[model samples]
Target: MNPVLKLTDVTRIHGEAPHEVLALRGISFEAHPGELVAVMGPSGSGKSTLLTIAGGLDRPTAGSVTVEGTDLAGLGQHGRARMRRTSIGYVFQGFNLIPALTAAENVALPRELDGVAPRRARAEARKALEEVGIADLADRFPDDMSGGQQQRVAIARAVVGERRLILADEPTGALDTETGEGILQLLRARCDAGAAGVLVTHEARHAAWADRVVFLRDGVVVDETGADRVDVLTGPGAR
Candidate 1:
């Protein structure tokens, strides 16, 4: 089966001249259907940079990124925006929900933005919420819910429309340990159900939930290994 997301020798450089910052360099990665790849790295290690480029939120300075075989660099601004709304899902560290929108409404926002009818978008939103085991919280606004509930709503929003590629950057950053594990379980389930997932995390325990782990340092892939070996790799003095 084709990988849902692929990055080939992707490099992202910000600014220019002597001040140029290399955020990513020759990073080739892929997340296939039914796989969850964890990206573990220190701050400024380019994990987030890789994710942003994969999601079409930023362009690569060289090489290419493809989601389901469509080269993101070839898509014009509007086309990339449409692809993001229709085929890619992003879960950020912050919930990023609209304050006035209820959980279901927030989950439905992407579909609606993609021009799906309101009623149908709402229906799909409910289904997404149910899948995340938060159906009853549908009508609750973000401010009215606890952090875990709000994050659940965020997950629902990300996966709402059968989006094949899910990119999560420190999604559990704000939650407690138990809540974070719960969130990881949800992501694992989604990947099990065939969505390609890339999770950027700093914790070894969290990376253990993934099928494999990719370690990044100074904007380059330093090491990669199966999840079973993540403990050895992430331990103190291991790098």
Candidate 2:
């Protein structure tokens, strides 16, 4: 099957000359439709950098990033921004919801930003909320909801537009175990529903939800293991 996202020898660096730090070093990967891949690494290992570059939020100093066959390096800032708005969805560690907006309103924000009518955008948001099992909390603001519920709302917002590629960075970091599992299940469902996803996480259990888990160190992919082959690490060590 064709990949929804692809990265080829991608590299990112900060500073220059002797003081430069490489955030990513010739990384390459692919995510096909109906697949969920996990990027596992310790802090400062370039997992987040890879996600941002793949999503077009950050430019790689070398190599290429493509989404659904479109070369990201070829696009200007405005073009990349448009691609992010219309083709990719992002979920961050923090549930970045507007404090004053209700769950429905938060989910509809992206569509609204894209110039869709509020009424239609809201209807779509409702559907997304329902998909994430949070429709009943549509009227609740972020402060009024539990951490799990807030994260669900964030997931609903991320997937509301049916984006081809979903990039999640430490998506369950703030939730408890049970709640984290629910969030992982939601992401799994997205893959089952035909959206490819790249999940950046430190927890092995969370990475187990993905079909494959890749380990990175010092800005390079150093290891890869299938979920089924990771049973030993998925127990208490996963925490």
Candidate 3:
């Protein structure tokens, strides 16, 4: 199967030369439809950098990012925004929901921005919220909910419209263990249903939900292996 997301020799630098930091170095990566790749790394290891670049929220200083066959660099800002709304789903570490909108409205916003009718967007939002087991919280605003509920809303927003690529950064960080596992299961199911997923996580148990696990350190991939070998590679209970 073709890759839904691809990064070729990607590099990202922050700040000017004298004070700059390299967040990624010539990293090449790909995630195909029906695959969920977990990126495991310590702090400042570029796991989040790779995610932002892949989601088009940030551009690489050098090299390329392609999603569903479209070159992100070639799309320019508005084009990339369009692609993000229609084809890519991103779940940020911080719940980035608009405080004023309720869970359902926040989830529906993306589809509406993509030109879907308001009613249709609302319908899709309902389904997405239900999928995340938050249907009853549909009318609740972010500030009114618990952290776990808010995180569930974030997940619902990301998966709302049959998006082809899903990018999640520490998605379950705020949830309880059972809820976190449920969130992981939702992501696994989404990948199984033919979407490509990239999860940035540090937990081996969480990595077990992935089809493949990639280890990164100092802005470089140190190793990669199948999910079954994560405990061996990361060391049992390591992370």
Can you write out model 1's per-residue Cα lDDT over 1-239, one digit (the tens) per residue? 78898888888898997999998888878888999999999999999999999999999999899999999888899999999998899999998999999999999999999999999999999999999999999999999998889999999999989998999999899999999999999999999999999999998999989998999998888788874434324322134
- Top candidate when judged by TM-score against the true structure: 1
Candidate 2 wrongly placed segments (more than 4 Å) = 227-239
In terms of lDDT, which candidate is strongest? 1
lDDT of 2 at 147: 93
Residue lDDT tens for model 3, 140-216 = 99999987788888888888889989999999887788978988998999899998999999989998899999989
Segments in model 3 whose C-alpha atoms lie over 4 Å from true places: 227-239
lDDT of 3 at 89: 93
Backbone atom clashes (below 3 Å) for every candidate: 0, 0, 0
Clash pairs detected, candidate 3: none
Please estimate how well model 1 matches the true structure, expressed as its whole-model Cα lDDT: 0.90
Which order, best to worst by TM-score? 1, 2, 3
Q: For residues 168-229, write the lDDT of model 2, one tens digit per residue.
A: 99999999999999999999999999999999999998999999898888888777787444
